[model samples]
Target: MSIFPVYQDVVSIANLSKEQLPFFMRHVTVYKRKRLHHHDFAELALIVEGNGTELINGKPHELRPGTITFLLPHHIHELHTTESGPPLQVYNCLFDISLAVGPQSDPELSNLFMNSVEEFPAYTDLSGEAFEKMKRIYLELFHEYSGSSPGRNALIRAKLTEAIVLYIRSRPSFPVPGEKSLQPHPKDHFWEMIQYVHNHYMDDLDSTLLSEQFGVSASWIHRSFKKYLGQGFLQYIHTLRLRRASGLLIATDMGIHDVAVEVGFESYRTFSRIFKEMTGITPSEYRASYAKTMK
Candidate 1:
Protein backbone atom coordinates (compact mmCIF):
# COMPACT_ATOMS: atom_id res chain seq x y z
CA MET A 1 0.00 0.00 0.00
CA SER A 2 1.22 3.50 -0.81
CA ILE A 3 1.24 6.32 1.75
CA PHE A 4 -0.09 8.94 -0.64
CA PRO A 5 -3.81 9.05 -1.36
CA VAL A 6 -5.01 7.46 -4.60
CA TYR A 7 -8.59 8.50 -5.46
CA GLN A 8 -10.80 6.30 -7.57
CA ASP A 9 -13.89 7.34 -9.55
CA VAL A 10 -16.37 5.02 -7.83
CA VAL A 11 -15.37 6.41 -4.42
CA SER A 12 -14.26 10.00 -5.04
CA ILE A 13 -16.86 11.23 -7.48
CA ALA A 14 -20.40 11.46 -6.18
CA ASN A 15 -23.30 9.98 -8.18
CA LEU A 16 -20.97 8.41 -10.71
CA SER A 17 -23.07 5.98 -12.74
CA LYS A 18 -21.16 2.95 -13.92
CA GLU A 19 -23.84 2.03 -16.45
CA GLN A 20 -24.49 5.56 -17.69
CA LEU A 21 -21.61 8.02 -18.13
CA PRO A 22 -18.27 7.93 -16.32
CA PHE A 23 -18.08 11.71 -15.95
CA PHE A 24 -18.28 14.33 -13.16
CA MET A 25 -18.27 18.10 -13.35
CA ARG A 26 -18.48 20.79 -10.69
CA HIS A 27 -17.62 24.35 -9.83
CA VAL A 28 -14.94 24.26 -7.16
CA THR A 29 -13.76 26.99 -4.84
CA VAL A 30 -10.49 26.18 -3.12
CA TYR A 31 -10.13 28.25 0.05
CA LYS A 32 -7.37 25.96 1.22
CA ARG A 33 -5.29 23.23 -0.30
CA LYS A 34 -5.27 19.53 0.38
CA ARG A 35 -2.42 17.05 0.62
CA LEU A 36 -0.82 15.89 -2.61
CA HIS A 37 -2.75 13.12 -4.28
CA HIS A 38 -3.29 11.26 -7.55
CA HIS A 39 -6.40 9.70 -9.09
CA ASP A 40 -7.20 6.72 -11.29
CA PHE A 41 -9.43 8.77 -13.62
CA ALA A 42 -8.50 11.61 -15.97
CA GLU A 43 -9.12 15.25 -14.90
CA LEU A 44 -9.41 18.63 -16.57
CA ALA A 45 -9.60 21.93 -14.67
CA LEU A 46 -10.19 25.37 -16.14
CA ILE A 47 -9.24 28.16 -13.77
CA VAL A 48 -12.03 30.73 -13.76
CA GLU A 49 -10.65 33.16 -11.19
CA GLY A 50 -8.07 33.82 -8.43
CA ASN A 51 -4.35 33.17 -8.14
CA GLY A 52 -2.52 29.99 -7.20
CA THR A 53 0.27 27.63 -8.07
CA GLU A 54 -0.42 24.06 -9.18
CA LEU A 55 2.25 21.49 -8.46
CA ILE A 56 2.06 18.71 -11.04
CA ASN A 57 4.43 15.79 -10.86
CA GLY A 58 6.74 17.87 -8.64
CA LYS A 59 6.79 20.84 -11.04
CA PRO A 60 5.11 24.14 -10.22
CA HIS A 61 2.93 26.06 -12.68
CA GLU A 62 1.17 29.34 -12.15
CA LEU A 63 -2.63 29.25 -11.99
CA ARG A 64 -4.97 32.10 -12.85
CA PRO A 65 -8.00 32.91 -14.95
CA GLY A 66 -7.85 31.10 -18.30
CA THR A 67 -5.33 28.48 -17.20
CA ILE A 68 -6.18 24.93 -18.20
CA THR A 69 -4.71 21.92 -16.45
CA PHE A 70 -5.26 18.38 -17.60
CA LEU A 71 -4.06 15.49 -15.47
CA LEU A 72 -3.80 11.88 -16.47
CA PRO A 73 -4.14 8.93 -14.12
CA HIS A 74 -1.40 8.65 -11.46
CA HIS A 75 -0.02 12.13 -12.09
CA ILE A 76 0.65 13.37 -8.57
CA HIS A 77 -0.58 16.95 -8.09
CA GLU A 78 -1.56 19.55 -5.48
CA LEU A 79 -3.10 23.02 -5.65
CA HIS A 80 -2.03 25.99 -3.48
CA THR A 81 -3.72 29.40 -3.27
CA THR A 82 -1.74 32.59 -2.84
CA GLU A 83 -2.33 34.23 0.49
CA SER A 84 -2.77 37.69 -0.95
CA GLY A 85 -5.34 36.63 -3.50
CA PRO A 86 -8.90 35.27 -3.16
CA PRO A 87 -9.73 31.59 -3.24
CA LEU A 88 -9.03 29.82 -6.50
CA GLN A 89 -12.17 29.11 -8.48
CA VAL A 90 -12.29 26.59 -11.31
CA TYR A 91 -14.62 24.30 -13.20
CA ASN A 92 -13.26 20.88 -12.26
CA CYS A 93 -14.08 17.96 -14.51
CA LEU A 94 -13.30 14.29 -13.95
CA PHE A 95 -13.89 11.50 -16.40
CA ASP A 96 -12.74 8.10 -17.56
CA ILE A 97 -10.64 7.80 -20.72
CA SER A 98 -13.48 5.99 -22.44
CA LEU A 99 -15.70 9.06 -22.15
CA ALA A 100 -13.45 11.37 -24.14
CA VAL A 101 -11.58 9.01 -26.43
CA GLY A 102 -12.25 5.55 -27.84
CA PRO A 103 -11.15 2.96 -30.36
CA GLN A 104 -12.36 5.11 -33.23
CA SER A 105 -11.05 8.39 -31.82
CA ASP A 106 -8.71 10.37 -34.01
CA PRO A 107 -5.11 9.30 -33.46
CA GLU A 108 -3.98 12.89 -32.78
CA LEU A 109 -6.65 13.28 -30.07
CA SER A 110 -5.92 9.84 -28.61
CA ASN A 111 -2.26 10.80 -28.34
CA LEU A 112 -3.25 13.23 -25.61
CA PHE A 113 -3.53 10.25 -23.28
CA MET A 114 -1.18 7.79 -24.97
CA ASN A 115 1.88 10.02 -25.34
CA SER A 116 4.55 10.11 -22.66
CA VAL A 117 4.15 12.65 -19.85
CA GLU A 118 7.62 14.01 -20.46
CA GLU A 119 6.77 14.89 -24.03
CA PHE A 120 4.27 17.64 -23.12
CA PRO A 121 3.54 19.99 -20.28
CA ALA A 122 0.49 19.15 -18.17
CA TYR A 123 -0.76 22.73 -17.81
CA THR A 124 -1.34 25.31 -20.55
CA ASP A 125 -2.08 29.02 -20.16
CA LEU A 126 -4.83 30.33 -22.41
CA SER A 127 -5.74 33.90 -23.25
CA GLY A 128 -7.95 36.00 -25.55
CA GLU A 129 -10.51 34.21 -27.73
CA ALA A 130 -9.15 30.75 -27.04
CA PHE A 131 -9.72 31.11 -23.31
CA GLU A 132 -13.24 32.37 -23.83
CA LYS A 133 -14.07 29.44 -26.08
CA MET A 134 -12.87 26.95 -23.48
CA LYS A 135 -14.68 28.80 -20.71
CA ARG A 136 -17.93 28.51 -22.63
CA ILE A 137 -17.37 24.83 -23.18
CA TYR A 138 -16.78 24.17 -19.50
CA LEU A 139 -19.84 26.19 -18.56
CA GLU A 140 -21.93 24.23 -21.03
CA LEU A 141 -20.52 21.02 -19.61
CA PHE A 142 -21.55 22.04 -16.10
CA HIS A 143 -25.05 22.86 -17.29
CA GLU A 144 -25.55 19.65 -19.21
CA TYR A 145 -24.10 17.59 -16.36
CA SER A 146 -26.46 19.10 -13.81
CA GLY A 147 -29.61 19.28 -15.89
CA SER A 148 -32.33 16.70 -16.61
CA SER A 149 -32.50 17.43 -20.33
CA PRO A 150 -32.82 14.53 -22.74
CA GLY A 151 -29.73 13.55 -24.74
CA ARG A 152 -27.71 14.97 -21.86
CA ASN A 153 -25.19 12.18 -21.88
CA ALA A 154 -24.45 12.53 -25.55
CA LEU A 155 -24.08 16.29 -25.32
CA ILE A 156 -21.82 16.03 -22.31
CA ARG A 157 -19.57 13.58 -24.07
CA ALA A 158 -19.40 15.80 -27.13
CA LYS A 159 -18.50 18.88 -25.09
CA LEU A 160 -15.87 16.99 -23.15
CA THR A 161 -14.40 15.67 -26.37
CA GLU A 162 -14.39 19.16 -27.84
CA ALA A 163 -12.63 20.59 -24.80
CA ILE A 164 -9.93 17.92 -25.00
CA VAL A 165 -9.39 18.38 -28.72
CA LEU A 166 -9.16 22.14 -28.31
CA TYR A 167 -6.64 21.72 -25.51
CA ILE A 168 -4.51 19.49 -27.69
CA ARG A 169 -4.68 21.99 -30.50
CA SER A 170 -3.54 24.71 -28.10
CA ARG A 171 -0.29 22.87 -27.38
CA PRO A 172 2.84 23.67 -29.32
CA SER A 173 3.63 21.30 -32.13
CA PHE A 174 7.37 21.24 -31.47
CA PRO A 175 8.69 18.68 -29.03
CA VAL A 176 10.35 19.56 -25.77
CA PRO A 177 14.11 19.58 -25.50
CA GLY A 178 15.68 16.10 -25.97
CA GLU A 179 12.27 14.68 -26.91
CA LYS A 180 11.19 13.53 -30.31
CA SER A 181 8.89 15.81 -32.31
CA LEU A 182 5.15 15.24 -32.05
CA GLN A 183 4.75 14.49 -35.74
CA PRO A 184 6.46 11.40 -37.12
CA HIS A 185 6.52 10.11 -33.56
CA PRO A 186 7.09 6.51 -32.53
CA LYS A 187 4.21 6.19 -30.09
CA ASP A 188 1.48 7.03 -32.62
CA HIS A 189 0.24 3.46 -32.62
CA PHE A 190 0.53 3.03 -28.86
CA TRP A 191 -3.08 4.04 -28.19
CA GLU A 192 -4.29 1.60 -30.83
CA MET A 193 -2.41 -1.18 -29.11
CA ILE A 194 -3.97 -0.30 -25.78
CA GLN A 195 -7.47 -0.35 -27.31
CA TYR A 196 -6.67 -3.68 -28.93
CA VAL A 197 -5.78 -5.16 -25.56
CA HIS A 198 -9.02 -3.83 -24.06
CA ASN A 199 -11.03 -5.42 -26.87
CA HIS A 200 -9.14 -8.71 -26.75
CA TYR A 201 -7.90 -9.09 -23.19
CA MET A 202 -9.79 -12.36 -22.84
CA ASP A 203 -7.79 -13.84 -25.68
CA ASP A 204 -4.21 -15.16 -25.43
CA LEU A 205 -2.47 -11.81 -25.77
CA ASP A 206 1.15 -10.94 -25.00
CA SER A 207 3.78 -8.39 -25.89
CA THR A 208 5.13 -10.60 -28.66
CA LEU A 209 1.67 -11.05 -30.20
CA LEU A 210 0.87 -7.35 -29.93
CA SER A 211 4.25 -6.39 -31.28
CA GLU A 212 3.65 -8.49 -34.35
CA GLN A 213 0.17 -7.09 -34.81
CA PHE A 214 1.24 -3.46 -34.39
CA GLY A 215 4.53 -3.76 -36.28
CA VAL A 216 6.48 -2.71 -33.22
CA SER A 217 9.20 -4.66 -31.47
CA ALA A 218 8.56 -6.67 -28.33
CA SER A 219 11.01 -4.51 -26.41
CA TRP A 220 9.20 -1.38 -27.47
CA ILE A 221 5.92 -2.89 -26.39
CA HIS A 222 7.34 -3.72 -22.97
CA ARG A 223 8.82 -0.25 -22.56
CA SER A 224 5.66 1.52 -23.70
CA PHE A 225 3.54 -0.60 -21.38
CA LYS A 226 5.76 0.39 -18.49
CA LYS A 227 6.12 4.00 -19.52
CA TYR A 228 2.51 4.83 -20.36
CA LEU A 229 0.54 2.34 -18.23
CA GLY A 230 2.94 2.07 -15.24
CA GLN A 231 2.75 -1.73 -15.44
CA GLY A 232 4.34 -4.57 -17.33
CA PHE A 233 2.59 -6.35 -20.19
CA LEU A 234 1.48 -9.45 -18.30
CA GLN A 235 0.55 -7.45 -15.24
CA TYR A 236 -1.70 -5.25 -17.33
CA ILE A 237 -3.40 -8.25 -18.91
CA HIS A 238 -3.95 -9.89 -15.54
CA THR A 239 -5.38 -6.65 -14.22
CA LEU A 240 -7.98 -6.55 -16.98
CA ARG A 241 -8.84 -10.21 -16.54
CA LEU A 242 -9.11 -9.92 -12.80
CA ARG A 243 -11.30 -6.83 -13.10
CA ARG A 244 -13.68 -8.65 -15.46
CA ALA A 245 -13.66 -11.73 -13.26
CA SER A 246 -14.49 -9.67 -10.19
CA GLY A 247 -17.45 -8.07 -11.94
CA LEU A 248 -18.68 -11.45 -13.15
CA LEU A 249 -18.33 -12.89 -9.67
CA ILE A 250 -20.70 -10.30 -8.30
CA ALA A 251 -23.02 -9.84 -11.25
CA THR A 252 -23.62 -13.38 -12.47
CA ASP A 253 -24.06 -16.99 -11.38
CA MET A 254 -21.08 -18.35 -13.25
CA GLY A 255 -18.96 -21.01 -11.56
CA ILE A 256 -15.48 -20.07 -10.40
CA HIS A 257 -13.62 -22.07 -13.03
CA ASP A 258 -16.04 -20.95 -15.73
CA VAL A 259 -15.53 -17.31 -14.79
CA ALA A 260 -11.77 -17.78 -14.86
CA VAL A 261 -11.87 -19.36 -18.30
CA GLU A 262 -14.29 -16.73 -19.52
CA VAL A 263 -11.70 -14.07 -18.66
CA GLY A 264 -8.91 -15.89 -20.57
CA PHE A 265 -7.41 -17.89 -17.72
CA GLU A 266 -6.54 -21.36 -18.97
CA SER A 267 -6.10 -22.94 -15.53
CA TYR A 268 -8.49 -22.59 -12.61
CA ARG A 269 -5.64 -22.97 -10.13
CA THR A 270 -3.67 -20.14 -11.71
CA PHE A 271 -6.69 -17.85 -11.68
CA SER A 272 -7.41 -18.56 -8.03
CA ARG A 273 -3.81 -17.93 -7.01
CA ILE A 274 -3.55 -14.67 -8.93
CA PHE A 275 -6.97 -13.48 -7.77
CA LYS A 276 -6.06 -14.06 -4.15
CA GLU A 277 -2.66 -12.45 -4.63
CA MET A 278 -4.14 -9.34 -6.20
CA THR A 279 -7.47 -9.05 -4.34
CA GLY A 280 -6.62 -10.91 -1.12
CA ILE A 281 -9.55 -13.31 -1.61
CA THR A 282 -10.33 -16.50 -3.46
CA PRO A 283 -12.87 -16.43 -6.26
CA SER A 284 -15.49 -18.38 -4.30
CA GLU A 285 -14.93 -16.23 -1.25
CA TYR A 286 -15.25 -13.07 -3.29
CA ARG A 287 -18.57 -14.13 -4.74
CA ALA A 288 -19.86 -15.32 -1.39
CA SER A 289 -18.84 -12.08 0.26
CA TYR A 290 -20.87 -10.14 -2.26
CA ALA A 291 -23.80 -12.45 -1.65
CA LYS A 292 -23.52 -11.84 2.07
CA THR A 293 -23.57 -8.12 1.48
CA MET A 294 -26.73 -8.41 -0.58
CA LYS A 295 -28.37 -10.54 2.10
Candidate 2:
Protein backbone atom coordinates (compact mmCIF):
# COMPACT_ATOMS: atom_id res chain seq x y z
CA MET A 1 0.00 0.00 0.00
CA SER A 2 1.17 3.54 -0.74
CA ILE A 3 1.90 5.88 2.16
CA PHE A 4 0.19 8.73 0.34
CA PRO A 5 -3.61 9.18 0.31
CA VAL A 6 -5.58 9.72 -2.91
CA TYR A 7 -8.12 12.51 -3.42
CA GLN A 8 -11.21 12.09 -5.59
CA ASP A 9 -12.76 15.36 -6.58
CA VAL A 10 -15.94 15.12 -4.55
CA VAL A 11 -18.62 16.76 -6.74
CA SER A 12 -21.89 16.29 -5.00
CA ILE A 13 -23.32 16.70 -1.52
CA ALA A 14 -25.27 13.56 -2.36
CA ASN A 15 -21.99 11.75 -2.83
CA LEU A 16 -20.80 13.01 0.53
CA SER A 17 -24.11 12.10 2.17
CA LYS A 18 -24.09 8.67 0.55
CA GLU A 19 -20.66 8.23 2.07
CA GLN A 20 -21.92 9.38 5.49
CA LEU A 21 -20.13 12.69 5.33
CA PRO A 22 -20.64 16.02 7.14
CA PHE A 23 -19.38 19.35 5.89
CA PHE A 24 -18.78 23.00 6.96
CA MET A 25 -17.49 26.15 5.26
CA ARG A 26 -15.79 29.35 6.44
CA HIS A 27 -13.39 32.12 5.48
CA VAL A 28 -10.41 33.24 7.50
CA THR A 29 -7.60 35.79 7.32
CA VAL A 30 -4.77 34.25 9.29
CA TYR A 31 -1.75 35.93 10.83
CA LYS A 32 0.30 34.75 13.85
CA ARG A 33 1.11 31.61 15.85
CA LYS A 34 -1.52 29.01 16.65
CA ARG A 35 -1.16 25.83 18.62
CA LEU A 36 -1.77 22.53 16.90
CA HIS A 37 -5.35 21.27 17.15
CA HIS A 38 -6.85 17.96 16.14
CA HIS A 39 -10.10 17.33 14.29
CA ASP A 40 -11.91 14.22 13.06
CA PHE A 41 -13.16 16.03 9.96
CA ALA A 42 -11.39 16.06 6.63
CA GLU A 43 -10.43 19.68 5.79
CA LEU A 44 -9.94 21.65 2.62
CA ALA A 45 -8.33 25.13 2.39
CA LEU A 46 -8.70 27.08 -0.81
CA ILE A 47 -6.33 30.02 -1.20
CA VAL A 48 -8.23 32.74 -2.96
CA GLU A 49 -5.47 35.33 -2.45
CA GLY A 50 -2.24 36.17 -0.58
CA ASN A 51 0.64 33.88 0.41
CA GLY A 52 1.96 32.00 3.42
CA THR A 53 3.39 28.71 4.67
CA GLU A 54 1.11 25.81 5.58
CA LEU A 55 2.68 23.39 8.00
CA ILE A 56 1.12 19.94 7.64
CA ASN A 57 2.19 16.69 9.25
CA GLY A 58 5.48 18.48 10.08
CA LYS A 59 6.34 19.83 6.63
CA PRO A 60 5.94 23.29 5.15
CA HIS A 61 3.79 23.78 2.06
CA GLU A 62 3.80 27.20 0.41
CA LEU A 63 0.30 28.66 0.26
CA ARG A 64 -0.72 31.20 -2.36
CA PRO A 65 -3.39 31.82 -4.96
CA GLY A 66 -5.12 28.66 -6.20
CA THR A 67 -3.47 26.51 -3.57
CA ILE A 68 -5.86 23.90 -2.21
CA THR A 69 -4.92 21.92 0.85
CA PHE A 70 -6.78 18.73 1.76
CA LEU A 71 -5.99 17.65 5.27
CA LEU A 72 -6.96 14.16 6.37
CA PRO A 73 -8.57 13.48 9.71
CA HIS A 74 -6.26 13.88 12.69
CA HIS A 75 -3.52 15.38 10.56
CA ILE A 76 -1.71 17.84 12.86
CA HIS A 77 -1.02 21.11 11.06
CA GLU A 78 -0.75 24.95 11.33
CA LEU A 79 -0.49 28.04 9.13
CA HIS A 80 1.98 30.99 9.23
CA THR A 81 1.98 34.03 7.00
CA THR A 82 4.55 36.83 6.54
CA GLU A 83 3.06 38.61 3.59
CA SER A 84 2.02 42.11 4.59
CA GLY A 85 0.67 43.45 1.31
CA PRO A 86 -2.61 41.57 1.26
CA PRO A 87 -4.67 39.63 3.76
CA LEU A 88 -4.62 35.94 2.94
CA GLN A 89 -8.07 35.11 1.61
CA VAL A 90 -9.15 31.53 2.19
CA TYR A 91 -12.22 29.32 2.09
CA ASN A 92 -12.00 26.54 4.65
CA CYS A 93 -14.22 23.49 4.51
CA LEU A 94 -14.35 20.65 7.00
CA PHE A 95 -16.05 17.37 6.14
CA ASP A 96 -16.69 13.83 7.30
CA ILE A 97 -17.55 10.73 5.26
CA SER A 98 -18.15 8.09 7.90
CA LEU A 99 -21.81 7.84 6.83
CA ALA A 100 -21.36 8.84 3.19
CA VAL A 101 -24.53 8.28 1.08
CA GLY A 102 -24.00 8.05 -2.68
CA PRO A 103 -21.99 6.65 -5.61
CA GLN A 104 -18.89 8.21 -4.08
CA SER A 105 -19.05 5.52 -1.41
CA ASP A 106 -18.25 2.81 -3.96
CA PRO A 107 -15.28 0.53 -3.47
CA GLU A 108 -13.49 2.24 -6.32
CA LEU A 109 -13.98 5.61 -4.63
CA SER A 110 -12.59 4.26 -1.39
CA ASN A 111 -9.57 2.84 -3.18
CA LEU A 112 -8.78 6.09 -4.95
CA PHE A 113 -8.64 8.10 -1.68
CA MET A 114 -5.68 6.01 -0.55
CA ASN A 115 -3.53 7.21 -3.44
CA SER A 116 -2.74 10.81 -2.46
CA VAL A 117 0.85 11.58 -3.54
CA GLU A 118 1.67 15.21 -2.72
CA GLU A 119 1.40 16.54 0.81
CA PHE A 120 -0.92 19.16 -0.57
CA PRO A 121 -3.79 16.76 -1.39
CA ALA A 122 -4.19 18.43 -4.78
CA TYR A 123 -2.98 21.61 -6.58
CA THR A 124 -3.91 23.88 -9.50
CA ASP A 125 -2.78 27.35 -10.58
CA LEU A 126 -5.16 29.87 -12.11
CA SER A 127 -4.34 33.31 -13.44
CA GLY A 128 -6.04 35.99 -15.57
CA GLU A 129 -9.18 34.63 -17.30
CA ALA A 130 -8.97 31.20 -15.71
CA PHE A 131 -8.79 32.74 -12.26
CA GLU A 132 -12.02 34.57 -12.88
CA LYS A 133 -13.80 31.37 -13.79
CA MET A 134 -12.51 29.70 -10.66
CA LYS A 135 -13.71 32.59 -8.53
CA ARG A 136 -17.15 32.46 -10.07
CA ILE A 137 -17.57 28.79 -9.35
CA TYR A 138 -16.61 29.26 -5.71
CA LEU A 139 -18.87 32.29 -5.28
CA GLU A 140 -21.81 30.55 -6.86
CA LEU A 141 -21.39 27.48 -4.67
CA PHE A 142 -21.22 29.59 -1.54
CA HIS A 143 -24.19 31.68 -2.61
CA GLU A 144 -26.34 28.65 -3.36
CA TYR A 145 -25.39 27.14 -0.04
CA SER A 146 -26.20 30.21 2.03
CA GLY A 147 -29.44 31.15 0.28
CA SER A 148 -32.83 29.88 1.50
CA SER A 149 -34.10 27.15 -0.77
CA PRO A 150 -35.21 23.53 -0.66
CA GLY A 151 -32.29 21.13 -0.90
CA ARG A 152 -29.91 24.10 -1.10
CA ASN A 153 -27.52 22.22 1.10
CA ALA A 154 -27.50 19.33 -1.31
CA LEU A 155 -27.08 21.66 -4.26
CA ILE A 156 -24.19 23.41 -2.57
CA ARG A 157 -22.45 20.16 -1.82
CA ALA A 158 -22.79 18.98 -5.40
CA LYS A 159 -21.57 22.23 -6.94
CA LEU A 160 -18.69 22.57 -4.50
CA THR A 161 -17.45 19.09 -5.33
CA GLU A 162 -17.68 19.80 -9.03
CA ALA A 163 -15.76 23.03 -8.61
CA ILE A 164 -13.00 21.16 -6.85
CA VAL A 165 -12.83 18.51 -9.59
CA LEU A 166 -12.70 21.02 -12.37
CA TYR A 167 -10.07 22.99 -10.50
CA ILE A 168 -7.92 19.90 -9.99
CA ARG A 169 -8.22 18.71 -13.59
CA SER A 170 -7.51 22.11 -15.11
CA ARG A 171 -4.16 22.51 -13.39
CA PRO A 172 -0.85 20.69 -13.27
CA SER A 173 -0.60 17.57 -11.19
CA PHE A 174 2.78 18.46 -9.63
CA PRO A 175 3.62 21.71 -7.85
CA VAL A 176 6.41 23.90 -9.18
CA PRO A 177 9.67 23.84 -7.28
CA GLY A 178 9.92 26.41 -4.41
CA GLU A 179 6.12 26.60 -4.41
CA LYS A 180 4.73 23.56 -2.62
CA SER A 181 7.12 20.61 -2.90
CA LEU A 182 9.76 19.14 -0.59
CA GLN A 183 12.42 19.31 -3.31
CA PRO A 184 13.35 23.01 -3.14
CA HIS A 185 12.22 24.35 0.21
CA PRO A 186 14.84 25.37 2.76
CA LYS A 187 12.76 23.36 5.21
CA ASP A 188 13.13 20.06 3.39
CA HIS A 189 15.25 18.66 6.20
CA PHE A 190 12.38 19.30 8.58
CA TRP A 191 10.12 17.28 6.30
CA GLU A 192 12.52 14.35 6.53
CA MET A 193 12.40 14.55 10.32
CA ILE A 194 8.57 14.73 10.25
CA GLN A 195 8.37 11.60 8.13
CA TYR A 196 10.71 9.92 10.54
CA VAL A 197 8.68 11.02 13.56
CA HIS A 198 5.39 9.89 11.98
CA ASN A 199 6.88 6.48 11.29
CA HIS A 200 7.90 6.16 14.92
CA TYR A 201 5.37 8.14 17.01
CA MET A 202 4.31 4.99 18.82
CA ASP A 203 7.83 4.67 20.22
CA ASP A 204 9.32 6.87 22.95
CA LEU A 205 9.90 10.29 21.31
CA ASP A 206 12.13 13.16 22.38
CA SER A 207 14.43 15.77 20.88
CA THR A 208 17.62 14.02 21.97
CA LEU A 209 16.54 10.81 20.31
CA LEU A 210 15.27 12.47 17.16
CA SER A 211 18.40 14.59 16.98
CA GLU A 212 20.66 11.58 17.13
CA GLN A 213 18.53 9.68 14.63
CA PHE A 214 18.68 12.60 12.18
CA GLY A 215 22.41 13.16 12.93
CA VAL A 216 21.69 16.70 14.06
CA SER A 217 21.95 18.52 17.36
CA ALA A 218 18.96 18.59 19.66
CA SER A 219 18.63 22.37 19.30
CA TRP A 220 18.52 22.05 15.53
CA ILE A 221 15.74 19.50 15.75
CA HIS A 222 13.74 21.74 18.04
CA ARG A 223 14.20 24.84 15.90
CA SER A 224 13.51 23.02 12.65
CA PHE A 225 10.31 21.56 13.98
CA LYS A 226 9.07 24.97 15.08
CA LYS A 227 10.16 26.60 11.84
CA TYR A 228 8.65 24.01 9.56
CA LEU A 229 5.75 22.61 11.54
CA GLY A 230 5.16 25.51 13.94
CA GLN A 231 5.30 23.26 16.99
CA GLY A 232 7.98 21.91 19.27
CA PHE A 233 8.98 18.25 19.07
CA LEU A 234 7.03 17.26 22.18
CA GLN A 235 3.92 19.15 21.10
CA TYR A 236 3.97 17.52 17.67
CA ILE A 237 4.48 14.06 19.16
CA HIS A 238 1.61 14.56 21.57
CA THR A 239 -0.59 15.57 18.67
CA LEU A 240 0.32 12.39 16.82
CA ARG A 241 -0.27 10.18 19.83
CA LEU A 242 -3.56 11.90 20.64
CA ARG A 243 -4.72 11.45 17.08
CA ARG A 244 -3.93 7.73 17.23
CA ALA A 245 -5.69 7.51 20.53
CA SER A 246 -8.80 9.03 18.97
CA GLY A 247 -8.76 6.38 16.25
CA LEU A 248 -8.55 3.66 18.84
CA LEU A 249 -11.24 5.27 20.92
CA ILE A 250 -13.60 5.29 17.98
CA ALA A 251 -12.55 2.10 16.22
CA THR A 252 -11.58 -0.41 18.87
CA ASP A 253 -13.31 -2.45 21.54
CA MET A 254 -10.32 -2.14 23.83
CA GLY A 255 -10.67 -0.48 27.22
CA ILE A 256 -9.35 3.03 27.78
CA HIS A 257 -6.26 1.75 29.57
CA ASP A 258 -5.40 -0.56 26.76
CA VAL A 259 -5.98 2.09 24.15
CA ALA A 260 -3.70 4.46 26.02
CA VAL A 261 -0.86 1.95 26.27
CA GLU A 262 -1.31 0.81 22.71
CA VAL A 263 -0.69 4.31 21.44
CA GLY A 264 2.44 4.58 23.64
CA PHE A 265 1.04 6.43 26.59
CA GLU A 266 2.50 5.40 29.91
CA SER A 267 -0.76 5.46 31.89
CA TYR A 268 -4.49 5.75 31.50
CA ARG A 269 -4.57 8.84 33.74
CA THR A 270 -2.05 10.64 31.57
CA PHE A 271 -3.93 9.57 28.47
CA SER A 272 -7.23 10.78 29.86
CA ARG A 273 -5.83 14.18 30.75
CA ILE A 274 -4.19 14.75 27.37
CA PHE A 275 -7.12 13.40 25.43
CA LYS A 276 -9.49 15.72 27.23
CA GLU A 277 -7.17 18.66 26.70
CA MET A 278 -6.99 18.06 22.97
CA THR A 279 -10.54 16.93 22.24
CA GLY A 280 -12.67 18.58 24.93
CA ILE A 281 -14.08 15.14 25.83
CA THR A 282 -13.13 12.08 27.80
CA PRO A 283 -12.03 8.92 26.02
CA SER A 284 -15.17 7.18 27.23
CA GLU A 285 -17.32 9.92 25.81
CA TYR A 286 -15.65 9.84 22.42
CA ARG A 287 -15.88 6.08 22.39
CA ALA A 288 -19.50 6.12 23.41
CA SER A 289 -20.31 8.48 20.56
CA TYR A 290 -18.53 6.55 17.81
CA ALA A 291 -18.39 2.97 19.11
CA LYS A 292 -21.65 1.92 17.54
CA THR A 293 -20.45 3.18 14.19
CA MET A 294 -17.30 1.16 14.59
CA LYS A 295 -19.34 -1.95 15.21
Best by lDDT: 1
- What TM-score does prediction 1 earn? 0.63
- Write model 2 residue lDDT over 1-295, tens digit each, in one string: 1122222223232223223325656677876533344355566667887887776655566777877776665565667775565667887766664323245554543443433423324444567666677677777766765577777767766766665455545645554564343323363365556656765777877888887776788887877667656677777788778776765555446788998897788889998998898889999987786645445
* Residue runs of model 2 more than 4 Å from their true location after superposition: 1-21, 31-38, 57-62, 74-77, 97-122, 128-130, 144-148, 171-190, 193-282, 285-295
For model 1, what is the error of residue 21's alpha carbon versus the real structure, in angstroms, after optimal superposition? Answer: 1.1
Local distance difference test, each candidate = 0.74, 0.62
After superposing candidate 1 on the true structure, give the runs of residues whose Cα lies further than 4 Å from its correct spot: 1-3, 6-12, 112-118, 175-295
Instruction: For each candidate, give its TM-score against the true structure.
Output: 0.63, 0.54
**Per-residue lDDT over 178-293 for candidate 1, one digit per residue giving the tens place of the 0 to 100 score:** 32222223554554465477657889888888888988889988777777667788887898788768656765567889999988999999999999999999999987886776
Displacement of residue 197 (Cα, Å) in model 2 is 5.4
Candidate 2 lDDT (Cα, whole model)? Answer: 0.62
